[model samples]
Target: MNIVAVTSCPTGIAHTYMAAEALEQAARDAGHALSVETQGAAGAEPLDPAVIAAADAVIFAADVEVRDRERFAGKPTVTAPVKRAIQDAAGLVAEAVRAAEERSDTAPAPSGETAPLDTAPAPATKVTEGAGLGARLRQWLMTGVSYMIPFVAAGGILIALAFMLGGAEVAAKVNGGTFQGRTYEEITDLSALVEQAGYAGVLFKIGAIAFSMLVPILSGFIAYAMADRPGIAPGVVGGLLADAIGAGFLGGLVTGLAAGALVMAISRVKVPRALAGIMPVVVIPLVSCLVIGALVIIVIGQPIASAQQAMTDWLDGLKGANALLLGALLGLMMAFDMGGPVNKVAYTFGLAGLAAGNLTVMAAVMAAGMTPPIALALATVLRPKLFTPAERKAGEAAWLLGASFITEGAIPFAAADPLRVIPSLMAGSAVTGALSMQFAATSRAPHGGIWVIGLIGKPGLYVVALLAGIAVSAACVIAAKHVGRAVPAAASGAAAAEAPAPSERAATVA
Candidate 1:
């Protein structure tokens, strides 16, 4: 059989090429002729157009956008984040191949014998168009989360190192502009000060800044990935503006969509062909950035920042009942969206609150944010074949990432079965969030898993909260899946009860 594939990742870095190699190797191993396309920093290139023309199936292993889906219009295809292609390439390809066979069987016949676009059925059954908004959004967030993982891990380590080495110095660059005020200057000899000044410190600080910028970057790139060149500039600028203005997830989401739309609009406008090459890189970015930046700053930024501050204060001031409610919301946001805007809001607030001496709130936020992935990792461990062999392997790999507070490690499972997986993650995350609040665990570091214990107060309680949350999230996922399955079975039974059996004559005629 002939197969075609496209591989892409946001950074056009390691994962992109890795997935491409995996797909190519898998196709060869399966004795299938294959054509692969890569959409990278350079541009799109089909390995062989003729192979695509003759291919029986297509695989899009991409985190970014594929330029034109129209070319593969009728072919059976499987789409997934690029990392899946690398980590589980052979299995993913096998699944795609099997899906292709099913598609060929179920798909409508070609319009005519000359129909080059085979018009095969999709691999999975189509549901209501609106069925999985949460799942898809979660998938997008997971993509961002995965990409952001390295930034957080690296930043956290640098922060830890700063504390260990610098040890309580009130240096000038250590605290940056924030230390200008005596309020911040008096912040005990924690030596979180040395992080910004040391040789490697700048790199670590940059990583921290990058981590903070991650969601907006992902949101923008994701829009770009989906919408193509038209989407890149607007998405990125809008994301940055959203961050500057304090527009949370909702705002970032709006900006992401708007950026893509803006791109689409520009693409429709007629422009000189000679200028086309510069449009995406130069013209588009300039115009789109101006428009998006204005909209965010003027329309959305101030209100969001105000509201976020207000919410942060309320949570900080919480004594008993109020604390519980705030904790629930923080936990929900942390796990609900992974590292999306909602997650960022809670996390950012936590970090900011710590600077303001509201350590308890920060503790809750970190605890919740770290729980989902770790819990999901554990779930995969316990269930074994509940996940594919490749997924199980990825799950094991996630342990290190999860320990380092990299929530992106959970993306693989979430992408594979979003509906069943996320809620499980959220349940654990919420429990962790709530437990942290109850214990009043406090942390100074913005990012770190359990390793932040040294930088935090009440380390034992923090650990307890972390473990509790993980347990709850894991249990929730397993139970939720079982419960969800029953609902589907009930629906099927009800459908069966309402339908009449076919008569022998009718059956024969049919």
Candidate 2:
């Protein structure tokens, strides 16, 4: 039998290539012709078109979704966990050949005929498009947000380091920052300011430069999501217009959507064959950006600037009940889905506030985000009988994950029993958020959890708030599980985090 295969693993490290090699050796020993594609960190060379067209059957050994899976649609396919190929390659290969016989009996394309692309069934790995416009809009915006975060994290941390080293008064010595009304000399020139503020000035200026790119990066990526690479130039130009008019991040959001829509519309129009070659490079970018600039400057700029100012003012004045309510809301959002869309919304709100120099919101959001995992870890230890051995093992790693502010570390437990776990997490997070706000805790850095404690205002009180929330969440988990028949966690929940990264995804395996 002629066969084709694809192999992939989550990290795309050793396992992907290992599986491919195992399958290839098995096929050679069985005296069958086989070609394998390994989608790994090393790289993937797609199977030749002729090879795919001639294949009698296919096998997919993947721990993650296969890219462009429609290529194998209607073929007799055997799918299994990636490790299965490494462990039982001969058995899996036999299954594929047997499955091909059944496939021929059912949907007999002529012996040499290949299925047409349009007629192929949808791939199993596809996320449904039936989710509607609202979901797609959120996804596009999130693409931008995902790209924007690195800029914020880097800039915010550097600024915190500047303040830490320069005694929190370095801004007063910079070029025309809000003067703190003290008897001190300040300089406007970059060269002079560096000399006056020393290394603190250097760090602050570098951070400020990075911060300046935040709006443009967000806008560009949003447009990219909507219209692919053709949308980037116009989106960036729109962001520049937004910054020029003091419209801030809100203006950038508006400009990004507009740029993307415009590009999409332009792309659909027919153009002369000679000109079509340059349309993306010359026509679309030039035309779309001009429209985006006009829309920002003549239409939407001032209203967004006013709105941005109002939001900044409101955040600056947040205290008492108002602060507590906002904090609790943010907390609920963070714990709602752990690292899903709802969690991202709350994080984005905090980032917006951080950019506007409202540090308190950032503090509350981070505190709430850290609560769920620690709470789960504590619950596993304090009440081991309520959890399976696998969950208890996940709990051990959750300690470092939680301290590092990786809320997704708690996802394994949440997925097992969301009914009991989610509410407990939300309740604890709300408490932490409220307390952090009430204590006027502030974070100069966007992330780092307890490691960045020195950059947080009222760090002592912040720790107290974290501890309080952890206690509440853990107790709730233990109580909730004890009162109910504990559901056995899916063995697959163990895939939650073999490696930790600040911005990595928590994608589900099929």
Candidate 3:
């Protein structure tokens, strides 16, 4: 069979490409022609229309809805989550082949006159895969988070830039005396802002606008992950209500889940073929939104707002020892896996706090995350003999990686000697985290590591904490190396040949 397929994951980074490769390999093994589009962070080129038209079947392996889904309309299609494709690409290929054959057997005979390219968008046959409830929920939330990150980076960096340009006085004016938030009604003309605080005011306004979308995007995409495109409207509208009512990110989480659940339930109610086309586009979104709006307004709003406020109050009231302990815990998480799931958890928590006007969490998270790569790089420099030639090369790159807040640069070293390197990195990161909190070195930016020093509240203190962590981690690495096996430089040819490349498997943290 000839198949046209699209693969997309939440972040559209590693997994999208992985799934595409898996499907291609599966198709080739099965003696089928396959055209696959990978929709990832950098975006994707459209597959040829002719190729799509000629395909016997379509495969949608995506967490988010397939863009331009109508292009595959009326095709015999098989749909599964992107991870499913990675896990069982051969099964998906076989299923697509079956779907194509089934359609060929059932579809009406070809006629002289052709139907329009854009016709009723039939729901693709969804394939179920095994995963626990907890795993599925985590995957769904990650879907939301992955989509939400670009907004965080762009908005947070722009706000940081605004502060750099306008300084304290401009921040005071634009923030309406506090960072908790300022009303949209307070927005003034760009010309007027330029007259007042120049470019800084304009940037702050723009950044603020971008930051405002954090909740809706998170909610919408979470729903999108569960129910694809049909869930977006309800989820986004519910999120807007959540934001307006002071329910914040917590509320966004609830609404996203609720909207997704509602859409799924609605989709399962068997409608006539005549109504099926309209169901996804109109009835599902309309009904879900109306119910969700009512639910938020009448049942959940006040309680969630109160909880959000209480959490904010607790964060605001955190004192020396309490703050230090929190920072240390977060730091440990940051360095625990060097930009793996644990690191992302810490990073995501920091982002949540940044949105809540609690800047210290962001500061502590970044400082701790920066520790591992910097420390590893420093160790490689101080004891070059302890590392292989390739390790040394990786270490050289780690300096810039660590500085830029890409923690996975340290992964190659960790993979080689996890027992020694990981603990030391964690210890040093904890120290940095505690100190950052103690010094009250705050940052509005979610990332940009050392480069964003100018925007940090206590830039000097932050640098001092970072350096201190680097020193401690480096010392620990040197001490632990004494117990490890001989360096890769001493390895036999086959052993050395089996080693993985430093850049190949490293994860990117936003």
Candidate 4:
């Protein structure tokens, strides 16, 4: 039977695609013709509308509401949560088809003068809560984070630039101060010193100010994504509450979603007919903000500030050879897990240090972070014989991603052999970290490679630092690969099995 499906989840990241895959596979396994559209962070891209129109039935597996419901109005439509699509997709599809058929049979034939389907209220969508509240909340938070990335990058670089400018003009200010018989004149007159100092101070401050509200904005958007226009007010209010309560970005995200949920839930409680729409949009958001804000400011804010400060202080105090060691360790952590929390923590710490005039630390961190992927990439390119056909191909592709400093470029390799591979990665990153520190390398840009010279300090040393790290990582990876076979798949067998069944067979071939 011809079938169309749409899959979505609150996060619009991993799960959305996962659900679609499960449904598609189920359809194939059951020998039904199928096409699926995914509504995700990138937005909806359903199978061709014509296909959907011609299909015998449509299935919607979503947590967040899917738009364009009018298109499937008269078609037999099966509605389900993303989880059901994943957990028991075949059964769910059958049930959905049955439901659709029943609806189709019961509805009266279209009259000569038909009412437009578009004018009718859409069918109710479904959500799966199987992932637990925390998981769901975290996904909602990511929506905000995804939106906030550009703003942070823009604001951060501009502020960093301001610092560079100030550093160049410090000498003049100091000279003027000295000429006026002020000892501070010298400090102000050294442009390089002033600019550096300013970068560490005023420029950073500006960036911080610009980014301070980032979490709240992110939280608000996540709510918006979920509830559409109705989610806006509660999301904003919840974000503010998170900030007040000592909630960091994560907290803001949670509060924003919580606020949206609260508003939505409150809206469901009976209200005067005229006030129904306004209740959620205005009254609920307002009440949520007041409650959340008061609790956050009074209880949460100080702890969060103290925690952030402590983290900053720890990085600030990192010095000499140890600084390199610390950076190396962090870099290894980043590459080992791709973009997991461990990686994010290391990256966040490195960037935070950029505002403290400790660019060397950051330089080591960045160099080490990208070394594993890049090194492996190079190894694959230079000695194709060293890897399996699949591995070599992957390595070759990883090169471009590595060049752009995507640590996860090596994830496929690591996942295959965590025990052996992770150690190799650490060794390589440590070497890079140590060398960068030894060379006193400094960087201005939080990320970027050779092309970012104008944005970094001690470009020559930075290049050397990176080269050293890459060389070390490459050597380690190559040596390990020659000595070690592809990682034992015992641990990952179940995971690999979960890939499309065809993929499991491919793994066997490899």
TM-score-better candidate, 1 vs 4: 1
Q: For residues 176-239, could you state the per-residue lDDT of candidate 2 as single tens digits? A: 3332234345565777766787898787777777767767876886786667667889998998
Work out the TM-score per prediction.
Answer: 0.55, 0.46, 0.46, 0.42
Name the 10 consecutive residues with the lowest summed lDDT in model 2. 117-126
Q: Whole-model lDDT for model 3 versus the true structure?
A: 0.69
lDDT of 3 by residue, 1-510 (tens): 799899887678888999999999999999999999998987798999999989888888876657777676557567666877898999989888876775565433132111111110111112111122432454355456545545555555566567566653455565444333532223355556776667887877787677678778878867765666677798999988876775556567788889988998998798998998798678998899999888888888666556545544454455334888988877887887664445655677787788777899899999998888889889989987776444566677677667766575665566445578889998999999989988989997666576667668989899998998889999999888766333322121111212212121111100
**Which rank order by lDDT, best down to worst?**
2, 3, 1, 4
Q: Best by TM-score, which number?
A: 1
RMSD vs true structure, all candidates: 14.0, 13.0, 16.1, 15.8
* TM-score attained by model 4: 0.42
- Candidate 2 colliding pairs: none
Q: Using lDDT as the measure, name the better of candidate 3 and candidate 4.
A: 3
Candidate 1 ranges with C-alpha deviation above 4 Å: 1-75, 78-173, 176-203, 247-254, 269-283, 313-330, 333-366, 379-426, 437-449, 452-461, 477-510
Model 4 per-residue lDDT at 283 = 80
